[model samples]
Target: MYHSSTFFDLLLLASATVILSLLIFLNYIRASRSKPSLPPGPRGYPFIGNVFDMPSCREWETFTEWGRRYGPITYINLAGEPFVILNSLDTTLNMLDAKSSIYSDRPTFPMLGETMGWDRGLVLSHYGERFRSFRRLLHRFMGTRAAVSQHHDVITRETHRFLVRLLASPGNLSSICGGAVVLDLVYGYKVKDHNDELVHIAEVASLEFSCAATPGAFLVDSLPFLRHFPEWFPGTGWKKLGREWRADTYKVVDTPFDYVQQRRVGFTAIEEGMSEHDADILKWAAVSIYFGEWRGSDTMVSSTSTFILAMTLYPDVMKKAQAELDAVVGSHKLPTFENSDRLPYLHALLKEVLRWAPVTPFGGHHRLMQDDIQDGHLIPEGTAVIVNMWGLLHDENIYSRPMVFDPERMHLADASLFMYIAMILAVFDITKAVDDCGRIIETKAEFTSGLVSHPAPFRCSIKPRSLEAVSLIREANLMEG
Candidate 1:
């Protein structure tokens, strides 16, 4: 009886041991599965990955360093979340254009996507038939040769009017230029000064919205658990801000839309063509109707910022350009599209400004739908592929003295031929401008934590090289009218 009892005890012990071993094995497998196959990157702490390692300012420099350290394709962890960056131009092109089918989808960030509900914006929409529909419409309105030709007069007229404003008050050049363009694009009207109610509303609404929607600007994006917290909680500042932003956004959109709707009802004071209305107004109408929401403040802000920056920073380039204009266009006539082909320097200047400090510093984020080997690295599916515009723009191998702000490089012999090279661009800046901010504020500047980076509040001053040049541009504009 004693022998039999001992045998039974040994058998039970063996069974228990096997069960424990199996449990351990299963746990290991689960852990392995959770570990993503990500590229080499800086080690992160308990929750935040590499965020502490990065500098508050000079984000682009950090990105460039990471690219150098971890190859062209590098992975960054944001609060233990993995985000991949495409640092080189070739990699960016390959992901965005070559594999566009898979890479066109945007990263999922709650503030920019869910709260603001911008997964529907043409710039933020996923890669699908719906996105294609919006893109096609945008192309029809802004990209088509016929469409561009139709609005040529207005673009020139408005831009020239902006120049006049610069002449009047260079300090308000940024506000005046941006305000004028948006006014012409949206309402087919012009605000001669900075204090116009519509301009104030549009600018403030746009900037505020952008700040609130920036992905990492608020703590709620990093610690999503805070979202479940009560709105009254201090930690829920982002949530409260988001709610306020949403209302402001509605005000921005509805006010303009209602104004236009009222005019469409009976007002015949303005021209019927798009040349008279803001391009953004049309965009808002089209998007709101199609997607059941409107989020495009960022795009407007980017374009507006670009024009203002060019006016302020490109004075030297503009002076040199006027020399070209004087020789080809002469002082009596303002520069026109007809004279565009003749003035290569001005064209180069425009291109350089777009490249110098891209309004969208990070080109765009693309999603990888399938596992693939690129540049010998295993890029796993569901990764957010970010293209670093600053890196490409500042690549030493591609551009000589990349930081010198030299527009003249664009006109150097065979520069056009070199444009096809990996780090260069042609006429237009390909980066996307997204309205992720909940309600863009009218402050002329705000920082948002997102894939796209932009300039902060800046003052743009415009001064003519010669009084003769100013007279000539005005005369040319009058003749066209």
Candidate 2:
């Protein structure tokens, strides 16, 4: 009963449907083949990829474990964000160093870097012209031949001052010495005392920024939509914190430069006839390292603090280091940079300290610029590359009993390992704390989680290595005066 035209139309419709289905089936097959390209990781939930799996604290441990289970180059997804963890040093260097051009960009944080006006920060800056400029200026001052001869006096002066400070306060004594050195280096602003208000200002700003950088710390960072909410709106504390941090960090960026200008006595980039842009580049360049944008904690302070903690935990290592110093520099004078060449054990001790507990557990987040395959896994462009320095240093295959602290591992390596080796070893005799009843207090090899993994505040009895050491510190300080 159907018309011929209608019958043909129905047949044509059926054929079209069949062809469309076939095309879709073919596409599905292709997608299935490529779906496994993403690296293997803990099977995450469908909607939230490993959100709960990402640890809020001590993530380095879990990351290393993942590396062991999966491979050196492990992958994990955090709420749709792509992350590639490089737990092996070889893989880290292969990508981040050997192929650095494509892997060196930093992960951008909207709340911390953008809203906070930290685009100027060296660590968070986009990999572009500005960053390159900052690096060049920094290299000339820090990584060049002039850096040594110029800063040697300041370092020795600070180390001696550090020894004297230990004679007074045993709690977090590294602050005065470390802060003094950085202040002198960057702004040429000599910190006459530990109570310098500028140091406190920088400390507060850096700490706030660090806490903000923690993953999953702020919902606003993940959900930019929340940023439109009112300032007084409930749960918008992150917005307020971000604003406050921005102001503080900007001041951190600007205030010191201003001080250098006012004093006109220090080595600041704010020279006559230079444009505002150039001066700003120099100012932020100093901020980049001086404040260390990642954790905002000064490198000198954190390392020095951990050195003291390490000494307290391993008295035998401290004794051996002290002996090396005594043999080289003698008790008549505190150790000098010249004595560094003769102090091999002290150099090894610094290497072990850095390895035992890295200040930057996961070195700053580096974003990939192009898609690349590593060990058969695809590292898509823009993937957040986390070089887990902690994992690399703690690899059991590389270091025997990686958890234990031992300086002897590098005794045969070389003397020129790091700068502060002989300086710290010659200064303090950090030991176990005791109560009035002469009972030893408990200490843990624990670390606090942040952009930097500083050891948690622990009780340690800090003292000078010898009475002669104390006398030397006083004599050096007076000579400088």
Candidate 3:
């Protein structure tokens, strides 16, 4: 008694169900054939595939633990997307360094890059002719140690200014010092004593970048189709935020660029005569140098803060460094780059700072361009590769006591860090702050979690070592001015 139309609908429904079953069977067969080749990781559920296993924060620590459990190269899938974490230096170098051609590309960041316009910067740019051009421009300017030495005076002068600021107010040395130096070098812009507009804009944009770039931060990044949704739609509030941040990001790039064009004083790769396209390349390259440093996760700022934290926690190490500074550089004048080679212990201390709390714990993620077998594991194309820099640096096999902050165990040189630490130590004594009740405030060694890591804010006493040290800091500042 059923109508003909009902019969037809039933037939169509049966046909669709059969097709879906066949497709699932085929997919299961292919996966069974390939499962043995993929790297070992935590077993995942049927459809979600390791989504629940991912940590919400401090992912580098979790990745290090995984390295301990599942070998150096560990693999995981997030809703069908493949991710590989390289936990050892050897594996990182072997894949990222040796296999540069196949691994140089960057994974697409839909939220930060496409929506917020961060892809134009060097950090997230795709690997291609434009990327090569940016590299060439940077190399021509300050790629070599010798080239860096040309700006030694600029660095020293800025460091002196920072010391003077620390003398006056002993808080937030990270942003002021890092932003000032990069601004001067990149845009010939001098930061004001308070409320620098350019610095404010850059900081805003940088924070936005960090939040948007965080993994699982935005669903739009995972589901590209969400980007096409109307802002009035439910759960599309992020689109409005993306638009606001996009404007600020452009300000970070354009404001300084326009200032340089007007003043003609900052470091510029642009020449008198060039095609518009070439000129655009030069402009972005220059901005990259500036943005890379001042972009909230500045290496200089993080390292400088780490240096303070280390000195506060280990007074014995600080006293030893001061003793060496007294004997080597003396108190009559501030330490300069020329004296770096003579201060072996100070050099070691700087190295230990870099190793103890690396600025970028998980270095930039590199995208794989093709399928390849590594260490008997099949790594498919388009895999997002991350190098666990923290794990590699803190490997117990490499260092006797990885967690301890012992400079004597280190033997490496970073010029800028050496200068910052040596200059600060020459004048300031960093110790734990004492409460009004005459009790020493305890400081635990804790750091922030992000693409760029810094020591969590802790109270510390930063003051001149002696009357003579105060005089030296003031004299150096006056001379620089």
Candidate 4:
């Protein structure tokens, strides 16, 4: 009888286990059926899921093509992660702007943020109290046009110096001007004409950032668990690299910060007395201001470079701008912010530069905090959202002949870009370079592919429009000195 009872008990327990498993399976099926389907995208394989389909470079062009096929909002699964690409400006604004509460969060970058120590900076910082503190400090410093105008002297001086450098060595134009302006603005440290230490440090940090931040460049970014491996372990070479990059990252933040503390010069929001945490926030905020303007192609450097490239390619646009600049500011004096309102064509030209090569082809990724539905499709929580800024700017519906550089189509303006482009155009004439045979070297609108796109290096001649222009640049430089 005891043996019979044991057998019955075993059978009952087995039955209960089977019943529980069946119920759980039924619930899962029901939930799966109830859940909304994701938006249309290229079909993916079983386990990898669109990993191979993702473009290693020039992703914006691929995303744009997906937009053509799958509509404005295209969804794809990478492994288990959901990614939503917004190809239209309206959709990007609706999701990232209108629903910013959930869409403002930045995706975690294990390689760049955690290992390389970039999360301390504003660009890769997660959306939270700390991020808000950074924003608040920056806003207090230069939130408005009036606030920015307070530094007009710095801008005007650096810009004149840029003109001098361009006149001397046009080949080094890419590396010269932007760093000087930013370093002066941030630390009051005047960049040496060549081989500036601070500029080199920052440049190294920025290059590391680009490499580590590139998707799939480091295996640890995908398999974050790999970061736990010992440095001595095989295939752990990246750990050593990470250590070096982290050191550079901190150096870039601390070097100028220490300089500011020692001399008490330069613009700093950190006050005399504050809590340790508060002071740290202010420090990073100052560093952010430096990197925020200087690091990305979408900022002053790339925009100015694009302006130069545009002017070289489109002579008509350049002539129209110079005509406007001549009438408003004249050849005797370099254009100033005060003269901005008078030059409509130049304003339009600045806008065209931004639209033509959009420094950031893809806006930084925004992570979804909660599951949401839009246009009858589901965007799951933790989805990485990307806006194809290039596609939006080039959308055929929005601008006629979007590929062509036309200032007439633009109505908006960028202040820093306006200052740079207007000052340069007023003094210098940019044209295609001639070969040794005296034939004009034909160039196309080719640009580099990365987070920040810049016009590929092409031969272009940058010279003063007249001897008066050269005199004006020198006089302004001397006056600032």
Task: Return the top candidate by lDDT.
Answer: 3
**Of models 1 and 2, which has the larger lDDT?**
2
lDDT by candidate, in order shown: 0.56, 0.75, 0.82, 0.81
Count clashing residue pairs per candidate: 22, 0, 0, 0
RMSD of each: 9.5, 3.0, 6.2, 3.6
- What are the per-residue Cα lDDT tens digits for candidate 4 across 1-481? 9999999999999999999999999999999998888999999999667777878677778989999999999988776778889998888888888999998788877778888888887877789999899888788667877877887877778788888888888766565457676678767788877788987898788778766765557766555566788888776788888888999999988888888878888775356777889878867887788666333223577788888888889998899889999998877788998998898888888888888998778888789999998877899999888888899999999999999999898875756567788888998899999999999999888877766677787778888899999899889889988
In model 1, state the lDDT of residue 210.
50
lDDT of 2 by residue, 397-442 (tens): 8999998989889653212224445655666667789999999998
Instruction: Rank candidates, lDDT, best first.
Output: 3, 4, 2, 1
Model 3: runs farther than 4 Å from truth?
A: 1-36, 171-175, 232-235, 293-297
Off by over 4 Å in 1: 1-36, 51-56, 192-194, 213-215, 265-319, 370-372, 411-467, 473-481
Judged by lDDT against the true structure, how good is candidate 2?
0.75
Q: What TM-score do all the candidates reach, one by one? A: 0.73, 0.90, 0.90, 0.91
TM-score of 1: 0.73
Query: What is the Cα-based TM-score of model 2?
Result: 0.90
lDDT of 3 by residue, 123-205 (tens): 78889998899888788767888877887887888888888888899855653457676778777888876778887887788
